[model samples]
Target: MDLSDLKRLGHRSGTGGWGLGGLHETGLEEVRPVGVGGPWAASGTRASDAGEPGNSTAIAALIRDALSADQVVVREVSALTGGAIHAHHAIDLRAEGGTVPGDSAWVIRFPADPSFRIGHPPDVEAAVMRRAARVGVPVPEVLKTGQARAPGSVAMDRPYLIMRRVVGRAVASELVGLGTADGVRVGRRAGEVLGRLHGIAPDAGVVDGLIPPPEDPAGARLANLSRALDATGAVEPGLEWVLAWLTRNRPAPVPPRLVHGDFRSGNLMIDGGSGKARLVAVLDWEFARWSDPHEDLGWLSAPCWRYGRRDRPVGGFADWASFEAGYRAAGGVAIEPARLRFWQVLALLNWAIIALGQAGRFRRDRPETLDLGLTGWRLPELLFEMLRATAPEARAEGADAPPPASDAVVLPAPVPGVEDLLHAVRRALSNGLPAGPEEMGLLINAIGIAERATAAGGMARAGADWGDRARSIRRDGIPAGRSAAHHGRLLAETRARLTLANPRYLIALGLD
Candidate 1:
């Protein structure tokens, strides 16, 4: 879609669209608003300073201290888009003296909020990147890293990692829009990169400080999901059923390998400058860990990561055959279909929990963030997929079919209706208001939720006590020959949620 269309409908687009690829990246911030000026646009604002939190002066000083340089001149520091938990700034600097590189472009990364840190610290990430680079993986080189400390202790106030910036587009929409030829080529390269990454032996020093793979991967993951669900304190019968199904169908254990926990389209930096899209660097190693290699494969192929291109299973670019070929050509082990499917289901479950956690984080720590609040609303979508994937009927008859269409609910329009009120506010905001893309997205989503909830008559449709049913299923087992009824119940319950969370999603999937 064009920029104007994105601005009007808040649809998914390359630069600023509110749909799938736009707001879905794990921790990436929303794109800058359309028509907004770049960092250098405003008068009196020096190129060397973008008014971002990490100012050039402090960064230059930090570089000077780290390199023991006599002088360091920071030419510019501009905020890069797409980092939710961490803030990323591109730094251009020239240094003179002690082991200094003459001139360079680098990226400085640190937690947006120090208290909301996830995964390993900066030092460990630096070490992991170094190790990955040593093993032939395309990754940025870490120049310096700082540990989190009390205020006023250092020039860089937060724990941070500085690395040489690699030139490439990491946006998912842009990558997926590259068409079939480039998709296959990029997908193959990604597979090759991942193959090499997973080739890192379990005994390697890189495994230090990283969470090791569990003895029983499926069981451990199921238990973790159960605990996370409990923590959310939200009743999720569908998830419970999926949990029980997973418990029964645990895959046989395999040897552990280095897994890029969040390996997917958005996290991959692709360079198309040479005419063909190629994987230049694998980004976002914060979630890297020791686990079943299939975990990485499944995550790469997960439907959610496809950016709406479900046909191309491997990151919305290439088929499994091509990706598998690349992996094997790079000396990776052969993949088993059953194991891959198992991990794919687990991946969805893991993502659902993550969505809950992000929503919780928004409520508890960052109430002002509309993005996190929206993430919580995504659980229904995630859980719907989980139910479809793990339902007993799906196991018998294939699970690849699209969800069947259901009748759309019609609602009465009352005086001063909530949906109408939200639509009016949205129009006012979209017309001439000084709202940013983030604010616009929030308003659009709020309107969508209001409209859907209004149509559905409420947030949910009253029916069976799903929580009790879930408990029984988890305790006993899925009833034999009742797969049809089970599937129907799942569809009904999930559709109710989707109505409130995203009616467009239901329509797009042919469920409405």
Candidate 2:
């Protein structure tokens, strides 16, 4: 789930929207490659030789025992990528004429690290999938769900859930390039599928009480976001401003529904062929919950989730009108424009908090993931979007804010410039090192972190000035003529950040 290669995964071709999609398809179709196995293995090393606990050998043994069949032989295990919270691997095995078929490809999902869990546990995720499937939500079929080390066994330490392999790429970069017509078709289909998902009632024994239902969904989210922001220990003026705006403009509440908390382009599996793309499966139920149905709509339509195709509001692939038509056509509730915007603003704030947490993973949690570290640096764009959505006055008359004070200074690291250093390191990871699938994934993350780090100096300086301006705005109130100037400053700072972190997206969005 390297957010960096989203565009490269899919592309347009004359023979229809379908192309050789997915970086994992170079090895496994559904998942990305795992990082190099050991603490420090050079490129091209095998997982078995890397000496990690989740090495192919240990994983194969764990799978064999979980099946409890003597005839089963685990042949090969390759680490797959694209999961932010879990370590995914494709398990190739021979059943040898047992109840389980022979030469089958299965997936093993295990915790990436014990410290980075925010959703349901493995066992609960399995049960929720089952319940969701019972209600016609298309999910991969779960084969077995178990902890890595069952009570007395001293085997693997992580809990794992196994499922039959399903083909299709969820990476938006790969999906969006499937041609405009194909993109529309996939978007509508996804909207319809999401509507169907939201229509499901949480009456099943398994889903009931799975997670404590928030009595006041919006308030609960705000409270959680407040805590999350506090945990970040960094002052985000945009986040603070948006939180205040949301509090002041609270809308009439609605009943909660089963919501796929993270239902964006990257979480969908698109099966492409003959110039058409169909959503074959919905992935990532980690954030599934009982909440306002509008939350899902807003999340799906959020500017951040749109990836590079901001014009197409629905997951960056289809128009809001078509997506809403598909949703309402599928017997789901109607979209309230104001409510949707409220949730969209909330989604921005939520992602901002999550981004801070991702950065924290590298900073404090010792995950050392490039993905997490880079995510922290991309906050300016999200904050910029928040300013535009919730405080339109900030963009009034297109005026520009005053430049940063002369006192502004950023800690300068030695050697090549940050951007140059990042680009050099990323290039090295991509071509210099021969890495295993696990190592490859880590490399992807490393490149992403480097990409963001390229903007560290600018972001630090801009943030300091932005914080000062925000205080003045709060004290003097957003002045009628000055609001536009403030917005200009926000946009300029955001664009500067994206130039280093995601310059391609800026070019695509015409912001460059």
Candidate 3:
């Protein structure tokens, strides 16, 4: 298998700077050893300077002062990967006279960049998590939340949240690799947790400050994506078709409930022991809001979250049947097939939109992160994933013949074979080059992009073909012959490009 194939089994890329080779390591805000927590100490800064370890020392001191401790010692400060949108670190704290009473591991989360803060502010997020935890959702205990710079904390310039760090890994690759039975166990547990989360009453005040639960949840979501797409100024006909399809097949309104907007594999934490795996925590509540419960269900079951274990719909680890059983057992309302499909489609589109934003961050913001650029390279595959999900029904409705297998198209070539150069660099990074997981993920991702570029000529041709067919349908009428033809061609092109982009996905879906 090539690098792309290997990457399919890897964790989602981290938002960190990248390089082909040479030394690259994710800097900690402080180099506090795991077991030691003491007074403030400075450390090196990263390129962004936003996640400097020195700031971690300040945070440790801040926590110390907040807790009314004589002195706060940061035992360990380690940057935690996987929060692509936020910069975070796990700080093992030792407080002398803090209100909390003793030393413990805490997580401090701040924006990846100073200019952009996600959903709610730190205080708001802490409040939401506290409410969710009270309602029986497995979440970390929020210790403190504020924007005020604590005494002795000098590097902090924005709001931050300090929460008890829960154990277990959030890495998808590890969770997906759990033994089948163990994986299913984890999935069922996650389903139960989500069901309980949805069971929280709307009057619980969790949605305060966020937009009120929209009367038309699906429409509201689609409109949000439409706005995001508009902002991107990048045209995607497949995405446009998805928008139209969503409008045409809108599901009946369901009462809005608490939805974990980004509920999926990577966001969940799993504990494994004695040959079994269990859901430890349901995290990343930045996107949590009042929405249809099925929205959470669909997002959890989306193909993208499954990694390569596509057979297990609930996650990459358990089937929908098991997941649904757990959900029902936990008092979650029955999931409607149509509504589930609707949200699942929306989940794909929403993820694609987020990926676009990631790419845009790299292109527009010029962050030192290379993962953003690699994320941009995934647009075609992401759109095609949406098409694959939406096009099959139209095929049954009498669309035209499937387009021919993607044919080779010649394109400009770089001096050294691009794929080879990428592979070599990736090898260097993988083989003893000092780089953190985040940087390595980016390098691996770059290699995948380079490999996929080999098929760019074919993918571009297929996209143009589909775009023409799509425009023809748009110009004609809604239910005209051209619509079916367009759908069929769209499916064919999506499958062809998807085959090149991620054949593992097709095989996982039994399409291979």
Candidate 4:
């Protein structure tokens, strides 16, 4: 943390800045403290003034004052997770002179940048979550909103939310090797949650600024990719083609409902001890809204959430059979399998772009690190596989699903000399900027792979040859899972790179 960071945090009047690595150190210390938040007070400011820290201090004081007023005695402040959208922390509070209170915890959200997407509009999310909870969803309760808790807390015009904390592991990363029974549970619970959420009716006039539904079904998927790509700053040309094709031939989807715009394994927290993810507390509402319900099913099948075990179905637990069964049990209306594949392809494509945007942010210094950036480099290949898997069905009716409209001609198989088969994967991971330790590991592997590919003159090989290679590997017990992992890395890098690569992105951020 620089003096600028200190100055920027000037919102909470009298509140001191933690400084660069201090904030993270504070977060890490929570697990096993070694002198973190203690009695280290620097009670003076230099003569030369910096307004940044003052802004943060003022906001801090504002919030502390709010807690003071409510007689909620806050003991300490620490960081929390807002998933990929925000950097957040928590506050430990005890009762004071209030009506009802004791030891309780509340989380505080902070956007990666002044304008980055965080959790959600706290007020709205609290309302929806509260309603959803009543509607049979296992969501957390809201204590007091961070915004409402402080007046004039919008120091940088940035938003933060506070909520009651809950428990569970990320269903995506953890439930990979579970059996069909566990898979069925996840699907059932997820379906139950979605059923209730879709059935919700937003408050009157609430659809204020949401993206409108596309003119046609094709338009919807293409629009989704276009918007995601637009945020990513730079997208591989192949994905652009894939987006076009999906859009041009977008199947007629069924009815639109309140879709969990981000439904996937990672967003769900299941109870491992229970042998099932009983606590279906849906996490991350940054993308939640009213949309097509079929998208949810497709989203569940997205390669990004598959946890690298392709054979393992939804949540990497059960196959489509179990997932669809659970969904149908929850009163879900079945759509065509090909349509599901379409959404599945779209889901991976969208994720790749979103990851690209994150990579851009890190590259631009908008985020702490390429925490979720790597995904940008991995999604395209997964999308390609998804498209290929459903190609027969997609083309069954003889419907011409032409590639999406774009002026960029497809490059000579993105991974030069590499077979066309791996072209999509190569295109998805167009570029990246590494920062995290895991990301650095990926970079090391990628460099080695690239070196080997170059030496082997893989570029001379056609797309069909690459397919043969992948098939041969599959025969030898390799799973042929390629894109999501690479895209994950690219997502982190693309966003980080964009801080300098794209003036438009910087302009949108008002940091230009």
Candidate 5:
């Protein structure tokens, strides 16, 4: 199954080194070798291997078994973006040695979950891929597919997938909001790209809820909610109820089109130095299908990809007008605002549930899981704020200041600083203040306020970051990699605050 000679083919074509041109410099070393198992790591070290040569050889055999392709090679695997859970790597192979006419750079994606869920066949991913491609969302042409090679687990675990490597850069985590002109360009381009995707003719639809969940609806609900709370520890109040309302009151579909259900910043990639800034590939087609085109539109506007820009609805590109314009330019029909708004609310609600799952995973000693869990707390609160602002009047009582209810929880002075409530809460958590509902409520309020402050800071922060990111992009080009990653962090933090303020004042009606 070894395909070492595959290196001689064309793997060395302009590979290696930062940004797209010279906008920024990614200090990354190690230009990943093709036909190897790992791309982020050195040439031959497999992320799945533990310094065991024999393990990789066995993996090669497994690849051959899974795919109809002639040969496969496992070199090494490297963790991508936050080095969080999922690991992405390069797999090089050829049809008949180097002599074969056909070839591909296989991407091996695996979960780094310490305890992976089980009870799924190896072909589930393959099946998802096949189904998705049929409806027009792009998937790596599957030469082969697989589940985790659990040697000693009681429950079969750690499902992994291998497919043709996508031709563009990994544009997920970094592509959230437009920060630099490059990001803005990328962000706006992403808008145009997704608009086109929403144009695909209707074929089918999906609602699997990506990560595995308990069989029952409640379990799934709890699982997703826990995930969000654990990751962010915040909530977007009232969004859940509104989404439920929208789900029930859906105004039927305007039209059906191929929808990449999970279309988000991290899922799509753009070719940088190649110019054009056109989306080189549509990815993560596991959620792809034909359905209400507005679903994709809503996902585009989801809080999950806010990249901290609550003001610009579509990945911080501009307003809804720009997004809608771009969509129309890309050939999608103008969708009903009411229907599309329902999906927008629906996207945040979906994310809110998932945030809880993240919290559950990390609340234990899982250090890696902690950040993911932290995200859970943020989105729920943010989404809650969105719903609150959208329907501020929903909470009936006199609109003007009435006597504060004794039960209306608010924290007494514990922190010395006026604005550093988060620091105070952190100190409390560290000192074992035992976070109960009361303490948690105060923490949430404090976070909401801080979030507002940060978002107010974005108008200023954006100016500062533009120079840094632009330098990186210029040094490298649009594929500014880590430069974009840095920007992504800033925006996420800022948008986190914007959601807290419920700025648009839309949630005011909910008070009634």
Candidate 6:
């Protein structure tokens, strides 16, 4: 189902479960649940013969081969949700004559298509985790890692990494549900862990395939954003304004350190089973790189990563003071507020561009799920927030202006209009259906988009000339004495788009 369905099921919409990688930003939905005694119980049948892609039997065999175990019995395997780029499975198995002791639980991470991975290779990720573990960072113990095999190779189809499953919750709803006190505790621990991770010198021979330290980190980031914005082929004046703002306000350079590219709440596994809550393991190392250490802090404190708790700057769990206290306690360098704010703005822009790429994937690859399409709906919200963060003063210029009115027109005579057809489809999908929750959620979201589009007459009614405006801004820069009006126009355009995508979001932000 969509994020709304996930919320209805008592789970928050942003953070995800085990091995979700970047997809943690998008909510997850389960299609079906596998029982304790599922199809993997059968003997003498290969996973391919059973008509499953990554069946339990095949995984057991892979483990056996990787660990050189005498035997491996996969007791159960259940598919975890929130895996758009990679397939994550929680597998419980008993191993004999191997390094692993007794019956243990573990997670298997492998991509369906290895080429689509945006991070380092599986082996590189495992090595990075090993390096982080060396510096007392809490991380999953890598059991086995295998690279992608060539076609016709008698091995696993894709690159895979197996690790001992640390017991904890990674979902944002559960983490935030622990209350402010516990969340602060976890946040302190997270800061300490990040501090330790950042202590690693970039020159250290940690592993291959990591992004090397750039000569100018801030400039490098801006160059990358420029390329990504151009790649999207859609002009975003809000983002263009951000780009210009960043160019004018570049941060001072510092020595590069290892950066956990996606250090935020969902990626942190919190062990709250005990009376006290603490961070157990930091996950999703595929996006790791070498950059300014403050990049991690900025990402952690970004508004979008806070999961609706704007009061707490650090992952919606703890205040900045507590997080900084922990950071200093762990030997982290003194943070500069101006530099931190720069990275924070960069983080929001980066995520907004990534959202556009996700929507592009949905349109080009035609993935089975509606998560990508829904992710695109987040663009307006992100842009609005970006503008607010960078140009808050501009919002006050025309803050009381009336919102754009809907342009939808009603025909005098028609048996079933577009709106009527969309409403009927939405009703039918909402009713009981043969499809599971995941499929039903996709259908529901698709219908919702259509309904919203119909109501707005179309989705592209805002800023038809944004491309031209963006080009002018880039060529000559935002003229002096026109910043407020420029930002006001961008905000209004973004608000219109947000009205179509999610009006409730506008109300929540007090912009409606």
Q: Find the candidate with the highest lDDT and give its number.
A: 6
Provide the lowest-lDDT 10-residue window in model 2. Answer: 11-20
* lDDT agreement with native, every candidate: 0.62, 0.58, 0.59, 0.45, 0.43, 0.64
| Residue range 28-139, candidate 5, lDDT tens digits | 1111111121223222333444324444454455555656445654544233332223445555554444322255456655554434322222355466556555544455
Which has the greatest TM-score? 1
lDDT (Cα, tens digit) per residue for candidate 1, span 417-503? 243335445555656763566466566665666665666554332224545776777677666777556766665667666666666
Give the Å error, residue 118, model 3: 1.6
In terms of lDDT, model 2 sits at: 0.58
TM-score of each: 0.80, 0.74, 0.77, 0.62, 0.56, 0.79
lDDT (Cα) of model 6: 0.64
For residues 161-224, write the lDDT of model 4, one tens digit per residue: 5566565554343556555677667766676676667665444554443344444544655764
Where is model 5 more than 4 Å wrong at Cα?
1-51, 65-87, 93-95, 98-104, 110-138, 147-160, 176-249, 253-258, 273-276, 317-326, 360-369, 379-381, 392-512
Q: After superposition, how far is residue 344 of candidate 1 from its true place, in Å?
A: 0.8
Q: Write candidate 3's Cα lDDT for 333-365 as tens digits.
A: 788898888888887776666555545555444
Candidate 5 lDDT: 0.43
Give the least accurate 10-residue stretch of model 1, judged by summed lDDT: 32-41
Score candidate 3 by TM-score against the native: 0.77
- lDDT of prediction 1: 0.62
Off by over 4 Å in 6: 1-55, 148-155, 364-368, 392-464
Model 2 regions lying over 4 Å from their true place: 1-70, 96-103, 150-155, 204-209, 360-373, 393-397, 400-512
| Candidate 2 structure quality by residue, lDDT tens digits, 315-339 | 7778776777777777788788888
In TM-score terms, candidate 2 sits at: 0.74
**Residue 186 deviation, candidate 5, in Å?**
4.9
RMSD of each: 8.0, 8.6, 8.2, 13.9, 16.1, 8.0
